[model samples]
Target: MTHRRKTLLRAIAPVAALTLALTACGSDDGDDSGDKKNDKSSSESSDTSGSDDGDDATDEPTEEAPANTGDLPLGQAASEEKEIKRGDGTLKAKITADKVDTGENADLTAAGFSADKVKGKYPVYAYFTYEITEQTGEISPGTDLNSTTAVLDAEGKPGSRFIAIGGQPLKGGCPEKDRELEWKKGTKATLCTTFLMDEGKEPTKLAYGMVNPLLWAVK
Candidate 1:
């Protein structure tokens, strides 16, 4: 086990002991005030400790940076904050990115996903969305055109290990081969996806999607 795990376990025993001891002391006869005070103190302590435990469990570890990633993968300039569902066992994904790179001509900070939702064991899913500039000539985003809402499963690189059930189809790849966007560009959409983590009840992940404005609608 990691040192951090060991420390958490060690702390648990002491917390339990302290709680039991105080609880027992409070149960003893008529020193009513003392008992009440002990109970109050115990409850407060537990609450604080509970918060710490929750923080520890929810804290995600750092992972490797994206491969072939652009500091910014959007064009013009924009910033958005949204939430989505993802992960192997049900989790909300908070996504945020800049529309333009700090100082790179063809680089834009595109909105994307960093997830761990997969079919098999210990699988991870992460991807980015580009609202492309919609190039005209040899100026392909490969040349030039902001690359507005580019595509998804670009060549199934990592593979469609995770399928998006509720969200509309991403633009670039097969442009609405699945469903059309709500409008054209600059629209918002919500995606209610149920991630299948284990043989459990609730879905593993849930997230809102803002892509292919042409397909995704406010509904």
Candidate 2:
């Protein structure tokens, strides 16, 4: 009876050991799989963070420079010769104090503007002569003169009280005329434009052009 019991015990011991070994091996494999999953998750998180940092580094702002005003004349006036180069053409422009007129003129009434409605100190008129010296296209002196012309006050600011009357008669300088006259190369014309000045606010200069490097009518 004792010998039979021992043989049975030995067989049961081997079977139990085999079962324990298999259980241990399964536990190790499960731990290794969990560790591999954790490593993959950590690597993915690191990659995502690095990509975000690279995006943030590229999203910054930059500053821009100011415009150049070196070629503009600040305070020039009439009777002085100014050589202004327009697109594809050059003009010899001149303004003269001798051609400037103010007060209640008969020509202003004849043109349709009432002297009674004149704002500012009084209505003033000036004559501009544009001689197209060199050109590759037709130039409209009247249109360019009206659009780009501005009178500067004594404070070096544009006069807000003035009304621009383009293409007025050269002799009377009143009754605004639409001078759409196109001058080809080597042509010249004397055009008149009127302005109304504020009381005691004398114009110090004239500025031309809607862009930088403006042609200034200096006093």
Candidate 3:
């Protein structure tokens, strides 16, 4: 009876030792899986934080306003004559005389212009004498004294129609010529135009072109 009991106890002890070893192995695997999960969560959190910072760094900046550099004021007469150069620096112009005159003057009549052609009641006229020079190229004449050349009031508004006197000869004044006069390189000519203004309106400047630099104020 004692021998039988000893054999059974030995067999039961081996089985119990095997069960304990299996349980220990399972516990270690569970701990490893938990550690892997924690590491993955930490990495994902860091990636999300980095992505947010990158978005902020790539944000667009605000725009600024343009600076106001030196520019001539409107209606202020220049102390001396001002020269305007063309974009290609080939043509140059200077305002020789700019003044207000009556449309009934002898120069207008002698040039074959009647008072009926003048639009305003008082028949005030704004005359501009421009001396243009072709520095490099041949510029077509009579093109510079067209409708674009206008007399502007103090508010920068253009005056009425240009006085046309079909290239007629005048007494003691420049002839009113309608034909195109071509200027070769290094040559110059005097061009003139007369604009009709409203009654009691005074011309403050001459707008030779669309730009402000081409505007010449009266003295």
Candidate 4:
């Protein structure tokens, strides 16, 4: 009876030990799988973060106004079409192209101011208009607009008959002592000028056009 009891006990002990080993092995396998899943999640998170960073770059706009209008040596030297409005003042002028002769000697004359430069030169005047204030002066006999009233030259120089006008080559301010009337709108005057061009710096002749303003000024 005693030997049979010992044999039963030994068999049960061995079986229990085997069961414990198997349970431990299963738990280890589950832990390894969990680690692999964690690695994949980490990799996915890194990829998403990089994508978000890339989107942040290149997320912002570029045009500038013409610098110093009518306050420079050559009208800011703009090759593009531009208008010199009164500073901080709202004065509109309807310019007329009474003459536009573009050849080897292209001459464009209109408005009250006349831009006299060698034809066919770089930085030449393509378009121009002047607001001759309602004043009194002699422009060119037929031209009622005052020549020295307050003229903006092709080089962006603002000239005034006023004595206190500043001495800036590009911009001229009205001197208090000699300021004449501004070239205003509604001046009933005839628009007359000739376009001339020539070889080099000398004006050769009037080659192409001489016209008159259909309707130059609007109040």
Tens digit of lDDT per residue, candidate 2, span 147-176?
233344555434322222221332333334
Question: Clash number for every model?
Answer: 34, 10, 2, 19
RMSD of each: 24.2, 40.2, 42.9, 41.1
lDDT of 1 by residue, 1-219 (tens): 121101110001123221211000111111112222112221111111111111001111211111222223322122443221111111112222211111110110110111222212111212223342221211101110111111121111111111222222221211111122221224332211111112122211111121311111111
* Cα lDDT tens digits for candidate 3, 93-197: 444434444443444344444434332322233344544443443333433332234455555445443322132332333234433454344434444443334
lDDT of each: 0.18, 0.32, 0.32, 0.18
Model 1 stretches with alpha carbons more than 4 Å out: 1-178, 201-219
- Which 10 successive residues of model 1 have the least lDDT summed? 3-12
Cα-based lDDT at residue 186, candidate 2: 61
lDDT of 2 at 50: 13
lDDT for 62 (candidate 4): 7
- Score every model by TM-score: 0.17, 0.41, 0.41, 0.19
- 36-121: candidate 4 lDDT, tens digit per residue: 21121100111111111111011001001111212222112222221212222322333332222222322111111112422232
What is the Å distance of residue 62 in model 4 from its true position? Answer: 18
Candidate 3 C-alpha error for residue 171, in Å = 9.6
